[model samples]
Target: MGLLIIRLITFLNSQAPETTNYHIAMTMLANYSNLHLISIGKIAKLCNVSKSTISKFARQLGFDDYLDLKDNAAFIENRFNNPLNYLSNILTSIETDGFDNYLNAVTTDINFLRVNLDFDAVDNIAKAINDYDNVAAFGLVFSESAAIDMQYKLAYNGKFIRTFQDDVIQEDFLRNAGEDTLIIILTNSGDYLTKQQIKLGTPRKDIFSKTKAKIVVISSNPVVKNFSFVDEALIFPHQTKYQTHSIMYQIITDLIVSRYRYFNSLL
Candidate 1:
């Protein structure tokens, strides 16, 4: 569970608000958690109250001020597995201030990418792709588009990249995929198909465990790294509730393509 979810759950479990201010505060946090972010004015507007009302609401929630609550919420949300939610929070935060806030958010995201990226893992993925005779990419509902995007980008470089949506096609590819084959999976929720081969679904866990080909997972959840069958795992920055996964997917795909180009240049 992401920190935003946890905070929301915690707030929900709290006793019913005794005052209007407290109620407003609870609502702000609740809505913010679901939406992934909000500003004081927005919260006030949504609650049909004055900005001061929202500020009082924050203090009632044990925050020193409104900004303190927002910052804390953003920090907690960033630690979770939901990159989309985390990104939403960052975007919301950006909207609250001027250009400086936007720049800070971008810088934060870039720093996060630098800190968490595993170059060795990326190198392994590049090598697998270079050596593979065939490559297939798979993603769940939210990730399917991203998978296709990656396929198109990789194909432009004269590589055979197949994108799979169903289990029948995936299994067919997996069965045919050898030691020199690579399977790239994209999932932010960390859940993928894992059922009968004919069903167009295969449990992500099973795919990792059973496939003989090299596997690379671009996931929001850290559990992807726990699978021994996975050859490499790349974790994108977590997003807040209001944000979408499209930006993160674009960033990850671009990084992979850049790496591929650099590796090819050396060859």
Candidate 2:
């Protein structure tokens, strides 16, 4: 899920279905394929509201203006190939290859991780979480779910961590972080470093450059190793066709937090 869509969906979920904000958000989602074509005037007319109403709706969703909202939408449009499309691909595979075959592929990925994952690097990350007073984990959509899971699991082990759902705030935190901060990027495909951009027009590389925090990128994408900004890159197994599912992130999070618990004598 792109951050823009996530915000829109969140807005829709919070508002009543008959509200103008809900109608506008539902319209934007339904016409997401042509989000660039959306304008305040058009949405206002469609929803039987004034242009000011649409602009207010945009601000309520955290955009400075309607144009800013559209710009973010365009950014998401370019960054993501639509995760739902990837889900459809998985569904097609299950239909064609059988559910048992799909499960076997998932098992193969789990087995590969169990065999190939570097326990030393896992311990190092866990140690960093213990050493640093401020730690934040970030990822997109499904990967973000893993970060939240990590936050919860670590809480039980007496390690409180932070996770951000909004990319704008996530970047703000990065830009202002101190040297004592430990930034963990939990990306399944590593697209955040290579392709993602902040709403302020800064690329991920630029944001990393501005941050003094130690950066660790845990990804299945091997290409992250080429990035100099990453202080440590824990590259996970990437041979599976189920990259869209992001199951590895949860597994890796469990491993890291479990190790953190072990180091604290709670395991």
Candidate 3:
């Protein structure tokens, strides 16, 4: 975690002098976990700067852009309440202990999941699906289970949905996706298959480009905002470092499924 903090500090230091608002940005980054639901525009405004300036600040930090910086900050902030002191604890835990370290990690993971529960996101997801005809769910590894779970729930409600786990299969599905298909992606890192799609550089941004079929991303990493193709994003907090299971993802999926089911009943 010292490495993470050092990397973050180095990135902040690299920002342009004119765009340097390191103090305010650091304050915001430090408090990011508490302000999980806050909008980027709001953060910029709070920093007394334009959104583009904030973006530049993020770029200076060696991030691909503002969203990347925000996401990374949020991930690090979520790991510990006190960003400054958390690094020492993290490193110490790594050296002196095993079972105690495991327990702390589990506790952190559970807390992260418990803290992030946004009803507004669930409502938006349900509304988006209600307006679309077909839904395509995509993810890899842990997220694969999330995508499949979403597909199952949607299918049970009589919605046309497909789940894609393999990158090749996912790309093919996206390429052939209809105009009325919504792409739902579940990822914690947001670096796996989705990054591959971006690398492909398809003119078919239209796959996630349409208003009719919008893209909704659920990720712990804030990098979801980097996808111009994505229309909406829901960020989950990164749970403990040790536990592989994602309770927040499961809960968010459940909320989305329940919302869609209820909406369908009304129709």
- State which candidate has the highest lDDT: 2
Ordered by TM-score, highest first, the candidates read 2, 1, 3
Poorest 10 consecutive residues of model 2 by lDDT?
Answer: 75-84
Number of the top TM-score candidate: 2
**What TM-score, over all chains together, does every model reach?**
0.53, 0.79, 0.53
Off by over 4 Å in 3: 1-107, 197-213, 243-245
Model 1 agreement with the true structure over 57-167: per-residue lDDT tens digits:
556544577776666564343343444443445555567665586565565665677687777766767766776777888875447678888888888877768876543
Give the worst 10-residue stretch by lDDT in candidate 3: 197-206
Overall lDDT per candidate, in order of appearance: 0.64, 0.77, 0.63
Candidate 2 wrongly placed segments (more than 4 Å): 1-3, 10-39, 45-50, 59-64, 67-85, 197-205
In what order do the candidates fall by lDDT, top score first? 2, 1, 3
Q: How much is the lDDT of residue 106 in candidate 2? A: 84
- Residue pairs in candidate 3 whose N, alpha carbon or C atoms collide under 3 angstroms: 11-61, 109-240
RMSD of 1: 15.8
